[model samples]
Target chain A: MLFRLTREDWKVILYNLGRMLHLLSFVFLLPLVPALFYRELDTLSYFFFTSGFTLLLATLLSHLCRTDEQMELKHALCLVALAWLAASLLASLPLWLGGACSSPLDACFESLSGFTGTGLTLTVDPDHLARSLHFHRHLLQFLGDGVGIVAVSLAVLGRTEVSSLLAFRGEAREEGIRPSVVRTTRLIFGIALTFFVVGALMFTLAGIYEGADPGTAFFDGICHSFTGYATGGFSPHSQNLMYYHGLIYEVVAMVLAVVGALNFNLHYALLTGRRREVFRDTEVRVFFFTALLLGALTILLLLGKGIYTSTEALFRRGIFQLLSAQTTTGFSTVPPLHLSLVWPLSLLFLLSLAMLLGGCANSTSGGIKSLRVGILLKSLALELKRPFLPRSVVVGERFHHLKDSPLTPPVVRGAALVATSYLLLFAAGTLITMAYGYTAEQSMFETSSALSNVGLSCGLTHPSMPAGLKLTYMVLMWMGRLEVLTVLVLLIALALSFQRRKAE
Target chain B: MKRTLLCLLLCLSLLPCAGATPVSVEDLVRGPQEWDGRTVTVTGEVVGRLERGGHVWLNLLDNGWPLGIWCTKEQAEGIRVVGDYFHIGDRVEATGVFRARCPEHGGEPDLHAENLRVVLEGRRVPRPVNLLLLALSLLLLGAALSAALTLRFRRKEPFLGYSPESF
Candidate 1:
């Protein structure tokens, strides 16, 4: 089927893909500033080399593929898939060259993890890695899966029909927040930048108050801000948020986590004086109540076990973890080993469920988004009412997002398909993990985390894990981030094109 | 004979005052069951700290597994910096009773230290500026700025068959 593509399709895909590569080249060079500032000359050299090579390759591709052809939906989807894969490979170069990872495959894994905003790490000891490299890892998450690469390109390249299709294919929301895609992209950047600055300042002050030096605090503040606002849970320190060990820092992180996971459309609406939408939006309401419910349940479980001696500990450790998991922000005050080894099974199950039912749709978070969950439940409720209704009774379901929209058949089907896809992906990963001899519960939890892009590990993700399982998780993270459809399209395209070539 | 007895008594007294046998962090984490309730000595760099109710919890990393050492305020004193992005934390030796799951602190695996001593003082990591890389970075920054400016100025052209006015 993919063999039906004309040269024009290839031109459009290559041209846009080249622009993305060029954009990424600029991004790669950004880490050079931190490397030079920290005097990590060795790591600085790798950034220079990789950035230069990418820029050169981008120029070549753009020059060769130069055409006025616009992108079709298939072209856009293929470009997005190829762009992500290429970006992952390019991002791995510096990591491998800097010796942050043990092998090229490990470096690729880290890059994929970062770009997916899944905070899994192959690096055994992050504490000893170069400061610039550590910052780069978090920065990747912010740029790649956080604000999104295609969105950034759209913001720079301006709005077009092709760019709009590309944006949709890139997993950015299709909501017409602004008249132009470019303007909407700019708005997204503006919101993210504003939050980044404010969040950094708050974290810096909190860190300094908690006894960190000004320089250390500022560096950590900015890095943490990027990850926090992106809902990418990487920390410069190996201990994650536990390294800070301050209530104020935890509170700052929590605030950013919640804000990051909120829908951009909601952010725009709220910023533009649509105050009532905050309370009326079904996704927002569902996310808030679900978080509260799970958090309370966690606290109660912790209390029942008499695990934590005081309410402070229960709230800080228990409540914080649940929120972190639900938001799909993997920051944790408690250690992963502790969670795996000592925490009650019920609490673990609750956390896994939270990971599965992630944050709001049209946000950076990954999972079967709360929007879909709310729709599914409403659909279920409508079905339950169908039995009681008399013959010839017309039933119409509606929910409020930006406005009151009918929960039509198409919308319900779309939600169900995506949610079911997520569950199937999670199940597949769980089975693979179990095949590797891991416990069923831990396997399910870890797989849910991977497929949801929640980076919480239950001591299952390690450098020494079975290579096949690691590969499975990388695929899961990729599929989860793209919402599965784009990847499936890319696969079918490749397969059909290859078969056509063989037949010829 | 009395002089010989006095020397022997002094040697015996010195043995009790000596530090406990050092245990690796890996061993402590892997065999917590065997190490539980047993007083042992461990030495590692203190990477993180949490203070509550007159005691401080220290995360000790010894190149292998990280272990937590819970110490009283007095024992935690004199440690100025915890390991982070910019500083190497003080290397400390802790003699404590290991708990695979402590009853007091939410079933966390930790060591309740009776004695803590700094073995090596950690200081600020040196980060001298690199002039060569700084110059290269400035060049790249200039190029990026120019590209951005060019794109901004050339907005009159329709992007991919969609005019801005269409919006």
Candidate 2:
């Protein structure tokens, strides 16, 4: 019954399926490094077997369903949605077969964490896991997540101008890349590589200084680099970031996380001495002030609650956690329970707001994003300033650095699409979690964290959480990572195609 | 004499810091074994149906925690599984005295129980039926894969299609 498909649709599906296979094939290399490093051939062999088998199946299926043209916007969205679902399904092979996860849902959640770059983990006793599995998990976040939807959208934008705008505005800001979406993808990858190298070295040195075992230090360094650069808050130790307990490590982590949250195009401009653009960029200015102001407020809250006996600990811990949460990075120097009363609630609110006002467009951080918030705020200000202005003042004519012209309908609609989708996803997660015996504040915090790919949990996230909630969180992660439009498109296409088949 | 006394005092202060135990899961487990009757440690997966009472039984695990843990019903309080390994098959580490099995037990003679301490916990909850169901599901999935492969080959016959076979 599933065999019948239009040649045109088949072409798009097959072409995309081939790319998905290739991507999965590339991910096979992740486990090998750690397997070799830890001298565990059993795990390496398992990885080889599972990845080879999965990729082979993917390729065969794609070949059987070969299509023949450039994908339509609907098809592209369908492709991405299918790609993520298929990837998660296939990726679960390793965890399931290798016995890394006992339940299929748990495997799905962990993979979602990787693909979405939300560093929330369901694994227990991480220190004992096969080195290959741990490395594979981190590598997923490093590669798939680092190469974001915006970058991918731009890469494949090609002649599909409208689709590109839809994708760009739908997922992230369409303002980061210029005329060519493909070129932007390449640039993001290049910059990501640079950050990877620098972040890895710094983290490695810090690990060594902290007197971590040599082998563990190296592994931690790799994991931290990816997590830090992607603004994924995953940590290797059970205690999260508390195990390191070094001021220097915390400072470095904060810096790397902030770097991750910064807009890639802005970074590119600064490197190229396009300093003027940086100053005029509203998203950049807003992200900085929001982070700075929130950081100060958090510090004050901690002081007021008498959480820290010393001012130094107050500033250090406060700033670290604030930036970590704001950047949507889940790295915690201390568990939320240990903090002063005012701090946890304050951090939760600040972090939720940060997630709501995510990093700049074309960056790894998730949430509503700083860019959308900036646009919304600007739109509000314009409405308020309306009475003083002369008639026929077309305010939508505002120029952005990356966009060659003024804000177009597609651009505005795209942003609105993402904004609405994000809120809906958050709402769904919250409603489900609240039903599972959580407070509204706790539910909102967790839902926002999952939707933004921000892994911070206020003692609510647990492995034994209801299966329904885990599945919901997984869907949120997928939606959060892809943003809303792509998943929506996929759903619509699938429904339409099914209806057409039934009519026949 | 004062200089000697100062040195002694400094040494005394530094001694406690130097002798501070490295608090790792492994260390905690080994402690029970070494201490014997005096607060010895046993870190294994919790096993059995944990009772509402303070006492809990655990089936200790050796390595990676993805596997489920078993514990007796007595000591399940305060311990919550945090991941996917929540069956009798899950792996967990527990710290308790190595003692003789309870008279009610039909298993091995040397069973560890009573003063069981949960130093490090994992996400392995005990659900015996669920694990059996998982095994059955995997078996079904394998059968389906095989059937799909067989069907693909059977469809390759010339009578089934208009086109001639090609290598």
Candidate 3:
């Protein structure tokens, strides 16, 4: 063997991995509630089988790899990456078994999309899917994006220790709302659950008012609520938010998607009555300006083209699409094909930028995140003044994110690193997709959608799509969900760990 | 002169048929502006049904494209089986006023049906169970149960004395 891992290291990694499997097993059974309500015997049996298999696997791992050794940063990063992949694999079973997805690979793709909270669907017909399967699809997003897989696990484990802290910081987030990781994770889930309930109720009432039956309304309500707050935009109906044809429903969903994209610490501040943080936070300021600018340009283009004439058209289609794209939530009132065909190339380009910018860091939304964008812009603006000032003047960049934190070289470098990686990935993915006969605009839009973890499709994602491209989007989603660096870090660690050590 | 007059009258009479010729749901969805507020005919299967007070929404699917049809409750109640996991919905031909954005329904794209007729009745789709999968599921569950029981009874001390703690 070229290299060897100590028993302790393997123990730490596998033990935590086992803990996650245990959680996943429990998550697998949650769909049973809908299954029982709908009396879907086949669907009910699918969960029992999948959940049992997962429990067995979890038990075997826990039995084999019991350990007390604390995990380091490298182990945490590796675990975080592996956890996403493993959970997706285990989670795909139920959907695959339920016949929601046509093939095993497609099922895995759907599962990964849900787990990554990317919201891209490979299902042939989501509208006709079993209610339990649909519930599981949206539930995966809530756990994967809303509460966060590691955060929930930490909260469930209720361990007030550095190991939990390391795992929670696996996504490269350097701060938490509380000092204790367990307490912080609990608070995160607490906020998510409260929003989920409120959002679901609003959507339910709106659906009922719009003439939907009570059962269907409640079902759609909880599912949409899960996806919206998670910024994971899977819908029971293929038309997405357009299914209800209710402006109030779209309005409420837009609000929920934006709220989901907000930084959790910001949510905590508001919950604790620190209302000033909403206006003072630099990320919040940047997000609002970006939303307004993007929304206006998109609406202007649509109006100039004479595609939509009414004022309400802007509210329903233009602004709704902008929020969905900007927040990296993939809900759409317009069919996805229109983004490629009906919309002008300029609008597609504008929305591509929005998807790449995404929402706040440490939130459910994906992409490079607005905090990084804020920092990068702040640094560039300060740099522009440097050449004009005296040599003695040492310009310092500062921005408020939860609190006053100076834009140090490391912070700026960190932001730039992720953003640059994302852009490079976006370009590469676009080129690959374009090679498959899609136009540059279509390729860029869909590429941005996938790499940003936004589920919006320019009609490239379908069951009949080429297998190679499907695999490419899957990789993009996985790396994008981890924000590139964690996956990169895991790769580097793997390379280092596998190399032979020098004789001492 | 009589033949020419008769031909012109026939040509003019056939013009309305051009508007009612069946178009796919995707056609209206993709290019609603062309037919906005115009009487049109579409053919597809009902994927789902949602009931309002006096109206019902029949979401139709053709070529995997879905568009909602807003019709009288009487028009929708005739559909016995809608498309789902276990059944293929009834195929229907509906004539209505296609609105690119209906102001009455919050600017949503829909067709308010004036004439609805079922062309084909839907039937239940039987899904044969995969015995291999069923057996594998049972086997896996049995294994899990056995593992739990075996571990619980046989683990007073770590099997190899290198264990840490119980999960």
Candidate 4:
């Protein structure tokens, strides 16, 4: 299986992976700033060692596997999966070595969660965690989702054709904003930067107003902004967003989450004076209506149960969770246990549905994206209407993304396949969790969370969870972030190559 | 007879004190059935707060899962800073009735405190600059900068050995 790859193919994979690691090494250095700022000397040492080691390894690989060949599609797919796995392992170094996690597996889980923008955590006593380490957690989310490491790597390498292919393989919908991949990546970063500044300011003011000190508020503001804008829900505090307890803070977070969940293409169109695109885009319409409908249902369910009697509580707690789930941002105003215990099964299922159908395509939010959901729903409606139409009539379907693209049979089939794959993955994870002695509701909720890349937990994810289950969730997160297909392709490629090797 | 009455009075005085069971935060979190609706005394560092109308919700951590401690605004007034990433919050002892599922707070696990006493005052955590690490970081950064500039001057991309528009 290993020999199935020619030297050139190995070079293509290793070289690109090395370039990515080289870029990632600089990111490791970034946490050092926070470490130094917080005067966390012990934590600072870990960052230094990890960064140096990563840089050294990257240099060695790049030098050894020097190649001029462009990456093939298979090589790109395999590289994308391997790079993410490698990055997750490497990133866990500081966490493990610093004694933040109980074991290397725990460290890897946390790192995978951060890199995949899944907010699940297994850190022991996050309240007492070093400031620098907390900052590093959120920074990883920013680097992983906000500024995609693969996209940034490709942008830096200036590989246009390969960059386009890797971007799609990495689950980003590639609609180039400019002629060059570098420019498009820059544009994405630019948009994220603008949102980061604005979000940080809003959160900072809200924190200060809510009785936090100026310095603490500012630190939290920057950290939360990164995670929030990425729709990556890793809070510095163990209590998550509920720690702030300010209505203003919650509202600002919601705004940032919704904005982050929006499609980057739509962001471009809106930013470049195509205001009508916001309303005309099918994904946007679907996301908006879906959120509203789910929000209403959640509020009614909570009210019916008398969980929160007041209108204020209904909107604040009920609607907030629905939005958080829908956006795939797992910021919780209520405790996870409370959500699991008090919420009706139907409400939990509804939230699971929201998670299963996540935010826009090419955005940080995960799951079978709104684009696919819209396509599938439209296709279903067309199928139902076709049978009732006159025999002579020809029914056609089209949907507006960047433009009105015709929804051909290939598009419908592709959408159906991906969505079905997601459902099956969710079901498999649920069964595995159930076999581990968790209740069906908890298993389904947690499985949906893992598969959708939504980090909301019903108390199933813990530091002491069975090792097998933890590994299951990690694989789910990885596959979820990659949109399942790329990981599938990598797996299939490996299998085929192994078979070929056996034949040889 | 007077001595016997005196002894009984002393015994009665001790009963009130003994009534409040001292328990770990973890015990209360795990065995809510045994402790719920019962008076318990817990000692921990006060962390994070949510201000309600007349009271505040405080999270108390003692090297275990954080347990919510609900106290009046007047009771919480003594806390200067809540434990967080930057500051160490006050360590305190709370005597309260534990509720496994608080009805008022939407089935949240909480403690309704009758009394709270600060055991230790929290202060701003010291963040002295580490000169050794700082120097090393600066050195590494400088080296990286030098390498990038060298690569750029050599007409190669700084990070990836290709011109920006070449592709």
> Best candidate per TM-score, number?
3
Question: What DockQ, between 0 and 1, does each candidate earn?
Answer: 0.18, 0.04, 0.34, 0.23
Which should have the higher TM-score, number 2 or number 4?
4
For candidate 1, the TM-score is 0.88
Q: Model 1, range B1-167, lDDT digits (tens) per residue?
A: 99999999988854532655678977776666677778788899988776656877788888746777888888899788777546798999888788766666544567888778898998887655456764675565455444533443455434333455653
Location of the lowest summed lDDT over 10 successive residues in candidate 4 chain A:
A163-172
Model 4's CAPRI class is incorrect
lDDT of 2 at A358: 72
Model 3 docking category: acceptable
lDDT score of residue A61 within candidate 1: 72
Clashing pairs in model 4, backbone N/Cα/C closer than 3 A: none
Residue A489 displacement (Å), model 2: 0.9
Candidate number of the best DockQ: 3
Best by lDDT: 3
- Candidate 3, A353-446: lDDT as tens digits: 9999999999999988989999999999998889999999888978998879998999999999999999999999999998999899999999
Question: Given candidate 1, what's the lDDT at residue B29?
Answer: 68
TM-score, model 4 to reference? 0.88
lDDT of each: 0.80, 0.62, 0.84, 0.81
Answer with 2 or 3, whichever has the higher lDDT: 3
Candidate 1 residue runs with Cα over 4 Å from true position:
A1-3, A158-161, B1-23, B27-38, B48-58, B68-90, B97-112, B120-167
